[model samples]
Target: MAKTTSDLIVERLIDWGVDTIFGLPGDGVDGFFEALRTHQDKLRFVQVRHEEAAAFAAVGYAKYTGRIGVCVATSGPGGIHLLNGLYDAKCDLQPVLAITGHTFHDLIGMSYQQDVDLDKVFMDVAVFNERLMGPAHAENLVDMAIRAAYGRRGVAHITIPKDMQEWKVSDEQRSKANVPMHSADLAAPLAFRPATALLEQAAEIINKGSKVTVFVGRGALHAREEVEQLAELVGGPVVKALLGKGVLPDQSPYTTGGIGLLGTAPSVDAMNECDTLIMIGTSFPYMEFLPKPGQAKCVQIELDPTRVGLRHPVDVALTGDSKTILQALLPMLKKKDGKFLKKAQERMKDWNELLTDRGTRTDMPMKPQVVTHTLSRLLNDDAIVSADSGTIATWTARYVQMRGNMQFSLSGMLATMANGLPYSIGAAAAYPGRQVVCVVGDGGLSMLMAEIATLVKYNLNVTVIVVKNNVLGQIKWEQIVLEGNPEFGVELHPIDFAKVAEACGARGFTLERAEDAEAVLREALAHPGPSVVQAVVDPNEPPMPGKVTTDQALHFAKALLRGQKDASKIIKTLAEDQIREVV
Candidate 1:
């Protein structure tokens, strides 16, 4: 029997082991959508509100399942909407295949509706970009796209013309190309020599220096055991980046937690105290936090040669896979008894103790730390957490202890707002049986709150916990720190997020106080479908365990006095009346 080109594409996707596709269908891609309907038994199509959400869902799926997640979009605007998510996937090294429908071959260059240079636009984001000029090329392009996504651990885009989608071909005529699998093999002896020389130089520095620290990143995820072993061998502490959170267990004595603006005290102190710093699989961008050029010798190991010394001044650059370099460096390194290890371990203990005390506080109006701690406790052991950027990220990073099985997904590179809700929806769709939660801030939730409709439409069992503080907390914090006063634009008029959820066909609850939090969360989690728990918290509460300087404190006090004089007077009169009645 003859098969339509769309059928061939679906068949090829099935061959590539794709069980689900995240996307929206339109006129340009109607044929593909129709073709998907016929294969309903084998493949599940998840309809999302926007192409960007679909792309993000693909990223979530790939991150959790370690498979090539797929998303489809119509040409032009639909395809363009995918760039942000694609950039996230690309930077995070998540494997995703993006299939976009293009204008008909007959309409080529004539500016037909929804006709644009999708291949060219997607080129920078995707590891491989190709357009299907003919029906015969469809299978090969699909296979290549899948292969590129897997091998490069990034996004790949393939554009199919509407005319090509309607073409018919016999089963025998359809080409079947087997995609190549990724291998962990090293290139050659020359590749080893350069890396070996760099490793030797790094070892010499470690041997001479009494204090050395190891900083791990996402690139080191695959070589965690080796990285840990190296850390132990050197008796140095291992600090990870946000993306590298679960690569090494947080409870490990060698683990010093993450470093950056959102980093913990242990990581900062360890990094600053170390005489030599070894960076593995992380191109951490904050040069201000990194050691000065001549302060502490810096050694970096990365797979991409271009990334070497790009951010910080690298005294030694090793170009290879993390595991490969670590394996080679293991035998050459000499074990040393150093104070760096003991000092870092002690600092880690103190930092953890401080975080635990702060997080467990039973304060009125509810502390962000307490909220995150309670959420962490209530969440399923294997629940996938998608956190949006801002103060919530800082809180979650500090308090939420991720287990090995619990996956944490984030828009690391893009740091885009409104990502948490859609990302969680995608995560829930990808892993339907697992509990998926989106810990979002008020500002971020407002950005893509409409995705709640997508959740209801799909009946995805995802819980969204909106931290309704009525302001961009991170921006507010920055204003306090850098500007020395409250900014006008940081404040937001409160919205009824629970009502918004209810209107979107999902269950909703408003948390009025700290005591109401646990019960509200439980009800949301127990709901059969999507639910939003709007946690109302004090807008003026500062982040815990973070100190304000004397000058900043004085400024804050003066601002409070000037701003709340009338309110303070009313409070004082009430207190005086109560005292007089008691007397």
Candidate 2:
């Protein structure tokens, strides 16, 4: 049988080393689906309930494996649905490829059904965007798209018209004089390193400082050992951006967990006190959490020269991969007195003790912290975890200790809602043998409840821990603390997510009492297939910052005065939480 454009595109994807593709099938993509069916042995198609989830899953897979994740969809709405997830990949700089089917070529400008000019729609999000014109264009388009995604570390998009998918690919097409040939072989990643002179200059700035700090991010994950050595040599705490949570175990002597709003007290202190700031592969946007300008001499190490010194002004900039740059810079760093690091460790110890106290309370309406703290203890050493954006993120950041080979990620800069389940699905697909868990809040999980069915269908082992506090907890607090307004339109009518899970053919557990959190979490985690643990928690509890500013306290008080809902209960919980540390 003669090959078609769809066949050639699929073959090219296989050649580029893509084993999995996530998407939903539609009539516009029927020919492509047929091609996928014919090539089933070489490619695994993960059908998602929503096209959005499919794109999110691709981003998740790319994030976990450092490979070019691929997703597919039909025309118009399906193509539009992919924008959010593709934007997430673009913002985070993850490599991903999105293929969407368009209307028949003749019907494109005739306002045919599902014709939406996807090329223009995807222009802002994709690093490379192209369309398949005929059989001759398939291989070259796919090759160039994948290359662009990898080279730019962003999204690449291709729109195949319904009619084009059926075009024949034969020897005659290849023999055409106008046809251009291209190679589909996968290329090695560029190994970037900074010069010795730049490393020496960074070291000089570090050597002069008495109190230095290493601020790391996801870019530093590959150079854990080097980051640790740099922290030790500089005699300062190692603070991580949220995406960099697992780079060093929380228990490391040189580490202070995460920075910014969802961060520890010790990290805030490190940033405030440090005289020299070494930013390694982290473009953390929270300028308020960092040292004020001129308080510290900054040295930035970034692989993308365009992003170097983007967040903070740098005394020296080293453009290279973190592992190689740190390796070259480490030897030049002079050892400093252990005093600075020891003080930060003492502060971190105190902070950890406080977190333990907050997380162990045995209140009837379970504290959200207990859920994360218990899950942290029950997780396998090699587990992969994903979190949703909400107060649940605050709890996960504070309580979940990343150790061993455990991996963790969330919607870092995008901070989108309802990504937890899809991210776990992607992680499980990428590494089938490893345990995967998704930690999310009630509101976030409800946004994509249908994905639970996807897990059951695939028989993917994923434990979803839902902190069921019937409110949009994060925004509620933000209104009170940041805006000084009474919470409005934040209440969520309760749904028994456990029952919902059971209805979808997955095991479900509920935790109404704090005492049962650990036991329930253990069972859910040990379940052989998909499981859900709906933990009823106290909504009055706020995601308190490590340090509360006067304005925040005033705003919180003002909101209460303006008749915030459940004002008395909120005050009691807030007071009790704050009083625990001092007493």
The C-alpha lDDT values of all candidates are: 0.77, 0.90
How much lDDT does candidate 2 score?
0.90
Q: Which ten residues in a row have the lowest lDDT in candidate 2?
A: 171-180
Per residue, candidate 1 scores C-alpha lDDT tens digits across 1-583 of 5788889789888877789899989887887888899998888998888888888888878876777889999988999988888888998888899989899878868978887989989878989999886656667677777877877778999888877787776533433452333222221221343545667887787666667889888778777788878887788888888877777877777788887867777787777777788899887777766666777887788877888988777888887778888888888777878567788889778778877776666555566666777787787768888898888888777777776667776778777776788778767877889988889899998877888998998899999988888889887756654455544587788899999999999999987666666788888888999999888775655552232345555554444444432334323432432321210
Provide the lDDT at 361 for model 2: 95
The alpha-carbon lDDT assigned to residue 17 of candidate 1 equals 77
- Which digits, one per residue and each the tens of the lDDT, describe model 2 over residues 408-468? 9989888999888899999999999999999999999998899999999999999999999
Q: Alpha carbon lDDT of residue 373, candidate 1?
A: 72
Worst 10 residues of 1 by lDDT: 182-191
